[model samples]
Target: MYCKNCGSALDNNAAVCIHCGVPNGHGERFCSNCGAEVAPGAAVCMACGYSLSAQKVAAPGAKSKMTAGLLGIFLGAFGVHNFYLGYKGKAIAQLLITLLSCFMLSEVSAIWGLIEGIMLLSGSINTDADGNPLGD
Candidate 1:
């Protein structure tokens, strides 16, 4: 193997580059398959025909669409759905709005959350704050 960041040879089991201190598969400057220099953001390596346009892998613990939607529908006034979706600001807003108004404005927050929940269930809001797709 080779370090894509520095074009230096790497052990087969190595996880990082000894020369540049970059992790394996972490750069676009060189071909990992052939250790040849490649243009930045190039889809294919000209020297070895290696494909570089790999799809981004989703995180293992991605949020669930059903859970988020249900939370939004049931506890939207408290911003539970937003919190689960990593939308801290929106969650805090909803929570504060409901709390500050002593439940007088809870209906407004609930409506907002219900709309967001519907959007999530309908696939309009598919991704989380980190851009990871919500799970089934």
Candidate 2:
């Protein structure tokens, strides 16, 4: 691996470059795959033929933690927070648990959602289903 900002060699698991302070995947001066200096705003690296624009990610959503927490706290029985966070399976499960049981089991879902909401607010659950970091 290489530091994208300075073209310095880096460990594969490094989050930031040691030589340069830039985050591992945040720079444009160097090619991430080959550590070759790339032209400014170049779409492809000429040295090793690598795509510069593409990022290794699972579809970041930039979701807000506050909104998700509030939803989980207020409408957790309906799985609104989970739905907002892109956890469709969990949301549907909570919704079904509340509806199919005729609201008798609503507290179960509510408590579950409430716990998850608290976790989110506390930064324990920092990422959404797509592994995107939640915004403050």
Candidate 3:
């Protein structure tokens, strides 16, 4: 790993940069993969071809945390949040739990959604189907 703030080499488990005191994966001055200086507006590392695009920098689709949280809170019984996050199988299961049971066991699905919603809001569930970090 490398310090995003200082371009300094980093231990994989490092939480902060020893040279700059900045958190890891927080800087934009250099390439984390190659430690090469990256110019503003450059989409990738000219030397190593490491993509510097939004997906690379911000975790692919950048799923919205707020949207997922709200869906989990409001339509969780229908697995709305799971669907939004691309967990299709799990989402379908939740949806069926409520729909197939004709609401008799809706509480089960609702509680499940509620817990997941809380997890999303609390950063416990922070990635989407593509392993993208949820956007704030």
Candidate 4:
């Protein structure tokens, strides 16, 4: 294997490059397959025809869509769903709207949350604040 950041030869089991101190497969400057320097934004390596495009790696333990949708449906007035989805601002807004108004304006937030929950269940809102796709 090779360090994509520095083109240094790497042990197959190494997690980082000894020479560059960068995580293995972390950069696009060099090809990980053959240690050849690669052009920035190039899709394939000129030396080995290896793909240079970064693959989409799903985050471990992604949040569940069903859970988020249910939270939105049941506790949306308190912004529980937005909180679970990492949308702190929206969550806080929803929470404050319901709480500060002494529950008088809760229906507004509740309706808002219901629409969002429907959107989540229908895949209209598919990703969390970190841009990770919500899992089933």
Candidate 5:
């Protein structure tokens, strides 16, 4: 096999690159299939036709749907849940609408956040800011 981090040859069983100390498929410097240097953000290697980007792999510490849902339900007026989910813009808007207006229209923001919370718990809003699916 090859080390995607450094384009160095690797034992098939190796978990990380000896040269770069990065886990397999962690870096974008070289094509893992052919050891050709590729653009940092290039999707595929022109020389060897190897796809440089890793396929969507589930992460070990994906966010929790339940936690996000509860946060949205309880503290959505402050946009806490949206911030936790990485929807910074939405979070700021909700927070401002409630805080800046001195709670005059907090119900509007609260209901909006409550619905989002329900959506999150119901699997309708499943992805995080990076588009990674939330964990159960």
Candidate 6:
């Protein structure tokens, strides 16, 4: 393996880079697969075919999973929980489904939101729209 932080080669079992002191899998400067310098925000390495989509993990989101799940369960027909979770597109779709149909189709969106709520509470849907892990 290679140190993503420093482009230095590392032992497969090493926990940190001996040259840079960075913990394994902690940096974005270089590809861990090929040790090639990576561009900022690049999803894949140009030098190698290794996937880099999951390179960085943002800090846990401030939105609470309980809060979101509860909102989805209670006011999911209006997609209030999705709005709070930054899932504006899904929220708008749900809201529009209820509004455009004059509540006739509200149950569809309601069921959708309810399922999402349950998933959230069950840890099946743990990330926000930004892909940040939800806070407990």
lDDT by residue for model 4 (1-136), tens? 8998999999999998999899877988889899999886565688998756434333678788789999999999999999999999999999999999999999988999999998888666777899887776
The digit string of per-residue lDDT tens for model 1 on 41-134 reads 5656789887654433336787988999999999999999999999999999999999999999999999999999988886667778777877
Worst 10 residues of 3 by lDDT: 52-61
Q: Which stretches of candidate 1 lie over 4 Å from their true place?
A: 1-59
What's the C-alpha lDDT at position 59 in model 6? 66
lDDT of each: 0.85, 0.86, 0.81, 0.86, 0.83, 0.85
Model 6's alpha-carbon lDDT is 0.85
Segments in model 2 whose C-alpha atoms lie over 4 Å from true places: 1-61
lDDT of 3 by residue, 7-103 (tens): 8899988989999999887778887788888875455677787765544445545788788987898889999999999999989999999999999
Per-model TM-score versus the true fold: 0.57, 0.57, 0.58, 0.58, 0.58, 0.58
Cα miss at 38, model 2 (Å)? 36
| CA RMSD, predictions in order | 9.0, 12.2, 11.4, 9.0, 8.6, 8.0
Model 2: residue 30 alpha-carbon error in angstroms: 28
Compose the digit string of candidate 6's lDDT tens values, residues 19-113: 99999988888988999999865666879967665544436546788999999998899999999999999999999999999999999999999
Off by over 4 Å in 3: 1-61
Regions more than 4 Å wrong, model 6:
1-61
Which residue pairs come into collision in candidate 2? Answer: none
Q: After superposition, how far is residue 17 of candidate 3 from its true place, in Å?
A: 11
